[model samples]
Target: MSNFAESRADLESYISARVPLISIRSIEQDRALRLVREMAANPRRGNLPLWIYTRATGTRDLRTNAPTSDDRSWPGAMDFAATQFANRPQSTVVFVDPDDLSDDNSASRHVAELARLADANAGSIILITDNPLWSGLQRLGMSITLSLPDASEMYDVIHAFLTDHRGVVPIEWNEQDARRAAEFLVGVPEGTAINVLATIVTKGSVQRDDVEHLARFKDKHFGDLAGLERVEVAPDSQQVGGMTSLRAWLDRKHQLMKSDLRGTKLRPPRGVLLVGVPGCGKSLSAKAIAGQWRLPLYRLDLAAMLGQYVGQSEGRLREALDAADRIAPCVLWIDEIEKGLAGQNDSTGVGRRLVGQFLYWLQESRSRVFVVATSNDVRSLPPELLRKGRFDELFFVDLPDSDDRQEIIQLYYQRYVQREPTAELLDKLVGLSDGFAGSDIESALHDVGAELHLNAGAELRPEFVVEAFANTMPLSRTNPEQIDEIRTWGRERAVPAGRPPTSTMSGPQHAGRRVVVLSD
Candidate 1:
């Protein structure tokens, strides 16, 4: 007897009396059958019957252990039901192969014929298939849904099936482990789920993320871009630095997703688009976020995805997205997105369609894969991406403010220097490095250190370091106009990565953020 109940006494009572139809989808046949039995009372004198859609040829029926043969199509399924009822006079059950219900003309004919017989015989019908061809039959009758089993219920459902069918899965499935397994399998395709379950039973164990459990992506990488601290960082990651707003947002989102099985049935925003000058912490942020989440990081290199073959690039992109989804709770970092997607076009709307496909997946995907993409230029980014739900936020990383410069200098000095430097000397270094990109400061330091080492027989010296600074020409001077333009863009559009303390900074327009410059 099926222990699971499908509905309340009232609903079950109603379904048992009438020729009720139920539609169940996904890898839960046992649960679906249990639902049917619960909704059914004692078999009717002339009409009580059941039908199942399966592709497996019955070499031996499980309950009877009788050798059964001859695959039956959907229409034949009705005949089988009628025949069984005529002989047994109890509830006659017929199994129909879902593969029989294709969209081909023959398939439609079979479905129509089955509907006719079902109406005439006063028999009950249940369509259990994934996006089945008989979905159109819904228009004829009010179809009730058998909701997908929740994570908590999946183990019980699977165990029930195995006890009677698979002869595997231990009887006592721990609640915690079962919950984890259910969560891990959520959103996986049906074929993969079955294979995984079968492997676990037959082989004694199956490691997660194996080729047998491959989600859908192949191996690939996008090009590595230089610099992360650019003012125009990722759109969603922009207006950052405070961490207050973003932290709260992330916590909430994480809770919502976890309640649905760690994003197995939930989603956040699409991906990110980082735009700005080089040398900020944009790349660092990408890595840091993944580290914080304890998720694997995959870098997608577009250049590697590109190929001489037509559609190769698009294919690689699709593969990468699938892989990310399968290995979800992971991060896919696409550095310098504009360089690859900016100019590519195809006659059949390949590029456009690819972008649309990506957006569509982003909109509908329930996987936990988080995408972090960076770009140096935003002028040509498709407008569709700027839509509200695309990403969480946008950030612009400009030159380090004095306070940030001090922090950066301190970080590097402590990293490279054996002992702490004098505070007075550090302040002077921070001042002279003003208006300079983080990388420029590094370059300046490197040049000075190199000269000092060379002149003093590679021995570190304070005077030599001072002399190198005097001789070095900061990129700030050579690229003044460009820097200003970037800073202008950073304006209010960007957030501070290293905001000055309230006591040290003023209320200037650009006081807390990376600067933005006018195009002219």
Candidate 2:
């Protein structure tokens, strides 16, 4: 059942069973109030009388907004409620977010006393709060938590809004469009969904394109980002050198990400693990995935999650993971994941605990959070994380080979020089850039482009590009042993990111077994 329906049923049962103290935890106060009001009106619960007490409106009848009491204060309402529970049977009193409930304050103590009086008379006292009630007060009754609406609930809310405003506004959205828009609006509150639709209705027309803007609309509500850093991808930043295998894999997964898997057993595609050389396109591929899939990119900075106190790091990690789940259908990039989770011998057990917590969320969470985790030091990663099913697949991205380097050269050549490189110049540059990472090639071309731009009216020369390449040193050349170690580790375990070189391509092919990527 949806969270809303399940919570409603729980509330009804509590009221029917004469539960004296009932605590509801929810951020949507209005929705919770409406739920209580609706349950009270039902005949199964004998149409019980519900008295709602809000700070703004002291005490009022749930059926009508008319005040049931003259005094408009919390103490006065409590006094009136105590009197009713003492005399009347099956009375339901709801308090809307009264202050001083965090601990055993006077207000909580009074509520606890009132709850015992209600218990004797078989009446129910309901407390609607955004925060958790004190353990002493909460123990007096059962608590039900109402989460944000699911996809099905979102669809109803969106479709209802559109139906209500059909003639008022020009709407070009069909049923499918509404359903698609509802999927995007899944993690938002019901009122926020309506507000977003209203904002769109304010515009002249609600075209089919407006459905795609719903995610950006919901993004505005979560501006703080908690522990995540929003990584913006520009149009030009989407290009990657050459990971034909990874690109093709992501292309297939992108469709699954956008598809509606409501009635099926299939889950959306989990993310991939990119463990390869530094400066090679591991991190860049994260951005490229976000750009290609048209989903917002968020970087989970592990450094920000650490804390000096006990259990602080684990708490922070949970908050970050929960935040990611709330912002679903987005790419979560954890760059150099090993640095954060590779502690095997630390004196404190925080590192091991963090690893366990992360693995639990990754394996069990059904949210559409595509995790693109890259690591330069794979040896330090926990063995359990490397086991099957932790990630969909672990991909090894090595330095660009001759064919990959040629593609990288052409990509940067057009971007910086504003023209394609000649075939002869490309071959020579490709050979010269042997063993260079993708970033190294880009750096060399960027320098050449900057110099050319500074010297206005100067002609673009191949010699200038060659000279720029000559002056640079790549990491692979500086640390050959480290590169070899990474390559040897990946050679047997992970799938190669680049496609197999053909006979026509003139370069030494890296040795690895090619695994075929299958479609569901």
Candidate 3:
């Protein structure tokens, strides 16, 4: 059954049993109301009238916004609801996101009184809110959380929408396209999905490409990222030099991310923890994943989340994670994760709490927020956070080897100089940049490119590039011990991000004697 249909059935039973209070938790208020209205119209309930209350429209019929009560205030609505529940039986009143119910406040007390009347008269009071009610109030009744639609439900929603506007605007999307668009809009609400589809139609035509454009439309809804910063992933930014294993793993995850796994027991790959040498492509890998997948990139600044007041840091972190949940199918980059997760023994205990909270979210959240947490100081991180199930994989991004260096050299060479490097120069540069990191190569090439750009009359020569590389000193040279320590831990524990070191033959291989087929 569809999520909404299942929810409707559950709600129908609650009302049929005369449950005093029903709390429907969801951000999709309109969708929840529709479910309630469907339950009210159920044959078993005898199509009971709905006493829907909103702040703007005090008490009204669910079907129409026509006010059933003249006073459009909270106290007035409460009194009206109480009177109906006390006098009339089998009455259902729905309050749409009423405030001050979070505590034992006046509004909550009023709701409690209404609940008592509801129970005595065989009526029910429905609370539609995004947040959970106070334990005292919530304990009086049942509550069900309606999460965002999954792939199958999203497909039906999209199909229905497209059917509604079949000829209104030019729609080139086929069934397959609609299904693919539904996968992208999995975490989005039905109304938002339709609005996005309408937006595409507003452009005069809905091409097949509109399916991929759904992510961008979904991104527009979440502009205010409280604790996260949007990192722009340029097309060229995906030019990661090394980490072949990590990239291949991410590619597989990307396929799963785009696939329709609606009713499956399987879930999309969680994320990877990249720990290795500094100045390598660890941080850049995060951007590469975002760029490659064409998903929005958000950087979680742990430092910025720190606050002077107690619990403030944790609150901010929660808000950020909640925001991430809302904006799913996106990459969340946490650079230098060790720094944020460190200081577990601090007096304030905030760091420990933050670590626990982050790990909990990482494990429990079903949102498709692919985390790419990079840590140069992996040893400083808590051992619990490094558990096998915490991350999909812990990759050790060691310094690039000969082949990786060559690829890195060529990548930045073409990017900066706007031309491919010569074979002889590439060989020489690769041999020269034995211990250089990917960033080191890029920086060297950038200088060479700058010189070529500024000195327009100067020709692009291997000498200029070689000179720039020769003058560069990498992190491996400056901080050899730190690099060695990271590498040592990586070799023992994590998977290598780069291709395994290949062994070369001491001499040329002996040629095998040719064999002719005996039977023709």
Candidate 4:
């Protein structure tokens, strides 16, 4: 059976059993009310009259669509509901936006009394709201949360929307694109999905390239949520300098990562945890993965999710996760993950709870939100976070080796100097940049470019770069003890990002070698 069918069945069973109070938490009021009408019309349900009460529409008959009374205020509505149940037993009264009961003490008492009266009179009072309010009703009623449309329902929604606008606007999606769009629309409401589709096709025909438009639309949907920021990804052709091993891993999973995965046992890759020394391209890898895979990137700020009120933090976390799920097939990057989650020993235990929630979602979330978390201090991280299943792999991004340094130097040289480096210049810069992080290499090269620019278009020379390197102090030299600790941890626990260092020209013998000034 479909998910909605199963939920409707559950609702029918509850109403048939004459559950005095039924609380449904949902934002889709029309769909929720439709389910109530269907349940009321069930042949076995004895034709129970359906009465819906809203602030604007006081009381209306579901079948006839006619207003029964004009007492629209909260207190007035409660009194009217009590009168309806007492006058006619076994009627279903749905109170829309019943959260107002929590704000008024008299209304709360009135609802509680009405629930008790309905229980005795064989009638039901259903409370419908998006949030779970009125804790006082917990003892008197049962609540069922109606989730947003699932994949199958969303697919139907999209298909129906397309069919409705078939000739009005040009549509160019095949079955596969429709299925992919449905997956992207999983966490979004059906109404919003329709609106987004309408907005997209409103401009012109929606071709395959318009799939990116849907991603941008989903990003807007998540913009209002706290603790999550959407990051724009560069094109897939943008190359990341090093981390050969990590890049190779991504290449292997590239096919499955892009596939829809309908009939295969191959699950999409979860993501990786990059823990390493500072300025070693850990966070850069996170952004690069999104570009490499052609997916959007969103950064989750865990510390920003903490709220002053109880449950608010968890709610915000859930909102962020849901937003990620909605924008699936995207990269979720959490930089410096340890700083956000290392407070497990706090007095209030909020940290512990947050850790539990995050770990649970990390393991159980089926959405294709590939998480790439970077951490500089794994020592502060909880032990459970390092377990194998939390991430597909844990990589150690140490300082760049000789070959990686060469590639990084060349990349930045072309970027900053707008000219290619000669063989001798590349080799000398690589030698001098030994034990330097990727950022350190870029800094020195950037300084060289700035100095050259100041010299009024002077010809680029290797000496300028060498001088810049001499003036710079790499992180390895400044914090030797911490770097040593990180390298030691990585040696045992994590896989190296680049291949092991070779003995050709990376040693100290070449460190001080002066570049030969070859005349061009």
Q: TM-score of each candidate? A: 0.56, 0.93, 0.86, 0.83
Ranking by TM-score: 2, 3, 4, 1
lDDT by residue (1-520, candidate 2, tens digit) is: 7898999999988988989999889999988987787787797756576788999989998777789878989999999899999888888899999877879889889999999999999999988998988899988989999988988888889888888988898899988888778777878889988888888999977998898787677677788777898988889889998889989988898888878788999888888999988888998899998888777899998867889999999999999999888888789999989888987876798889999999999999888899999999999998988998989989999888898999999999999888999999998899899989999999999998899899979998888888999888998888999999999998779999988545754668677898999999
| lDDT of all predictions | 0.53, 0.88, 0.86, 0.82
Question: What value of lDDT does candidate 2 attain over all alpha carbons?
Answer: 0.88
| Model 3 alpha-carbon miss at residue 119, Å | 3.4
RMSD of every prediction: 10.5, 4.5, 5.3, 8.7
TM-score of model 1 vs. true structure:
0.56
Clashes of 2: 0
Top lDDT model? 2
lDDT tens digits by residue: candidate 4, 331-426: 999999887788657777777788888998888887788999999999999899999888889999988888889889888888878788899888
lDDT of 1 at 260: 41
- What would the per-residue lDDT of candidate 1 be over residues 1-520, giving only the tens digit for each residue? 1122343243355445544343445345655555555444344422443334455543223233354346544445555655544454334343433544535566555555554455555544555555554555555444444444433455554544445543343444444444445555544433345556665567554333332222222111212222111122233332223223334545565454334444354454445555566766566567656555544567777556666677776777777676566545456677876655554344555556556766787777766666777766655556665566766556566667777677666655543443455787777787777776666655666675555545665666565555555566655678778767766775555543344336535465554676899796
Clashing pairs in 4: none
